[model samples]
Target: MTSININKEKFGQLIHKEKPVLVDFWAPWCGYCRRIGTAYEKISEEYSDILIAGKVNIDEEPQ
Candidate 1:
């Protein structure tokens, strides 16, 4: 239901899971990223049972 905040360390494992996954790659300074982030969160809650939703802050973990 809740979105997971991930970094380079957790990305591979999370993406490899059996369930469907949605990952939002964004940076703090981007307005468009923030706008979509709200929508992403809502969708995550709505489809929590069917998929895994996560986010990665590109600025923090460029790798």
Candidate 2:
């Protein structure tokens, strides 16, 4: 399964779900974040049956 794009409005809801969630709060311009992104997604798919993986782009929703 693919990781979900978590916007600010739905962040709280996603975290509160019964199935545990893993959230990656990252910025597109950050090299380290970008470097690990592909690995993270692969992990998401691998564990999707037991958990939910989501990502938040801090640059898009800076508040």
Candidate 3:
């Protein structure tokens, strides 16, 4: 399963889910964040059956 694109508007709803949620808070321009992109994708799919994997782009969703 693909990771959900999370934003502030949807964050509240995602957190209230019965299932566990894993959120990756990142920024596009961060070098370290880019390094883990593939690994995160793999993990998202691996655990998708039990929990929801979400990615929040800090640049776009910074509060």
Candidate 4:
């Protein structure tokens, strides 16, 4: 499964979901973040049935 793009609006609901959740906090300008993103997506597909993979872009939705 593809990683879900999450923001403040969806965060609360996602965290409370029954399935296990993997939240990746990232920024567009960070090279390391981008590099790991691809690996994260691949893992998400492999374990999609058991986990909910979500990504939060700090650059756009800072808290």
**Candidate of highest lDDT:** 4
Q: Which digits, one per residue and each the tens of the lDDT, describe model 1 over residues 1-63?
A: 789998876888887888888889899999999888889999999999999999989899888
- When summed lDDT is taken over every stretch of 10 residues in candidate 4, the lowest stretch is 9-18
Query: Which model is ahead, 1 or 4, in terms of TM-score?
Result: 4
How well does model 2 score by local distance difference test? 0.90
Q: How well does candidate 4 match the true structure in TM-score terms?
A: 0.92
Model 3 Cα shift for residue 32 (angstroms): 0.7
lDDT of 1 at 57: 91
Q: Report the backbone clash tally of model 4.
A: 1
Select the stronger candidate by TM-score from 3 and 4.
Answer: 3
What residue pairs clash in candidate 3, if any at all?
A: none
Instruction: Write the residue-wise lDDT of candidate 4 on 1-63 in tens digits.
Output: 799999998988988888888989999899999999889999889999999999999988898
User: Can you rank all candidates by TM-score, best first?
Assistant: 3, 4, 1, 2
Taking the tens digit of each residue's C-alpha lDDT, what string does model 2 give over 1-63? 989998988888887888898989999789999999999999999999989999989888775
Prediction-by-prediction clash tally: 0, 0, 0, 1
lDDT of 3 by residue, 1-34 (tens): 9798999878899889998989999998999988
Residue runs of model 1 more than 4 Å from their true location after superposition: none
